[model samples]
Target: MQRMIEFPTAFWVSQYTIRFAFQEEISAENSRNVRLFRTFLQQALSADLLEVVASYATVTAYVKRKVALQPLREQWYAQQASIEVSVSHTPIQIPLCYDEEFALDMQRVMDYTGLAYEQIKQLHLAKVYRVYVIGFLPGFPYLGELAEALFVPRLAKPRQRVAASSVGIGGAQTGIYPLDSPGGWNIIGKTPLKLFQMQRAQPFLLDVGDCIQFYEITKAEFRQMEVNSY
Candidate 1:
């Protein structure tokens, strides 16, 4: 059965701001609950609501200055009790090149995981990753709860700068560096895909609660795609 929590009593602190918090224990086996929670929160959006943010396991909804806290809070509680969200099964596929030229720390990854290059590729490509959050950098997505066997620690010392498009793994999480910046995560591969393009109407390519899948591509293909401006 699905689990849920609710905040029925609203605590008013000021004319504009009120506080309400709920902690619901959800199934962590997959990203379904995360996605459902995000969808449910989005349904709450209206003129009175200002923002809605979802993290790994929690969603926060903010309201506008004119909205009355107590009535809105009560409505929110009722909505939460009745709302049902369908989890999405479709995954967004991303193409990446893991050749030595593009892979910054391939050897280190192989050594640490005690797995062959092919094995590393298999593990990475096999699973569908859920975007837990988008932070640290604009459009930088923190993805996974990688298969336990593939979990690896962050680098002992962070690099002064890592290249943009760098794909890295740290702990149970994996991410792509949207921009060249200082970071401690272990680099595994690089994607030619432009994760964050400022020129695009939507600057961020990925958002919280979305699913991502990475596919291995060749260096030549990567170059060709880049040339074509894909």
Candidate 2:
């Protein structure tokens, strides 16, 4: 059985704004519930009625002033108990190059995790990662709960600046830097893919709840692909 808690009376911060919060106690055993809750919100509410955001364990919905809070809350409760979302299983494949030059923190990762280069590569490529959320940077998708064996902590001190297209892992999360910016995550590798291409109609490649996988590519292949524009 699923559970949901709701707030009523429309807690008003400003005259035009009201707040309602729900905490869905999702199972940690699997991330399926997280994905289901995301899809449910996308389906149940009209495009203008509410704005929904999902994290590893929680889903928060923000409704506009014109929308009725009570009905929205009730509908959310009903949807939580219903099993209806058919989430797509098609995983997006990303090509990565882990050459020492690209992997700025390769030795650090080896020292921290006590794993050889091949072991690290195997663990990273072995599992299918889930797109938990897209925040922190535009088009930057927070992926995983990487296999326990590959987990590593964030950098003790963050770099003043990190290059765009750099891939890194911190704690249970692994992500690619969508643009050049200050970052603290341990750099593992880099990808040439334009994750957030402003020229594209959609702009963002990965959306919330999408699945992702990474495959290793050679330096030569990376250069050729960079020129060829796959």
Candidate 3:
């Protein structure tokens, strides 16, 4: 049985921003709640609403003035009481290349998690991941809830550059670097899929509520697929 998702608590965080926080662990349900709340908030947006950030457990709205806050707050709760959080989600299959050339820190991750390379890759493919939020970088996704046995900590010294599309695991979460950037997550594999395309109608390929499934592929297959993308 599922517990009802009550309306989240909201408080004024700044003169022009208010944050609505949910009381639930990081799960697909909570992710849906955040997504729904964010979607609902957009309906009440005025010129005063400067920005909105929907995160794992909270939705923060930034407005132009304090006077514009109350009406938005009233609107949010009204929608919260009347809106439905759960929506159908489509699972996306992401092909991953776990070859040594792409998996820079696989050995280190294996050492830390006590998992063999095959075990690690197979385990990763077995579970469905939820897209909790898309932040930290353009089109960068923060997917969550890795199986506990595969949990690994971030590198003590962050790497100067983690190649784009490199799949990495940090603590209990797994994510892909949308573009080449410095990061500390343990690199386990690389995904050939284009997660972010600048010219596309929607710059981001995945949304907050979409599901992700990782599957293994050989280096040759990865190269073959890469050729087709261009």
Highest lDDT model number:
3
The TM-score values for the models, in the order shown, are: 0.81, 0.80, 0.86
Clashes of 3: 0
Compute the lDDT of residue 120 as modeled in candidate 3: 91
lDDT of 1 at 18: 40
lDDT of 3 by residue, 66-177 (tens): 6455665667656664555345576898999999999999999889888899899888888899988888888788888898888998999999999988999998899989
lDDT value, residue 88 of candidate 2: 70
Clash pairs detected, candidate 1: none
Better of 2 and 3 by TM-score: 3
Give stretches of model 1 more than 4 Å off. Answer: 1-31, 66-87
Error of 3 at 2 (Å): 9.4
The ten-residue window of minimal lDDT in model 3 covers 79-88
The alpha-carbon lDDT assigned to residue 124 of candidate 2 equals 87
Q: Model 1 scores what on Cα lDDT?
A: 0.73
Could you tell me which residue pairs clash in candidate 2? none
lDDT of each structure?
0.73, 0.74, 0.82
Please list the residue runs of candidate 3 whose C-alpha ends up more than 4 Å from where it truly belongs after superposition. 1-4, 46-48, 64-86
Model 2 TM-score relative to the real fold = 0.80
Candidate topping TM-score: 3
| TM-score, model 1 to reference | 0.81
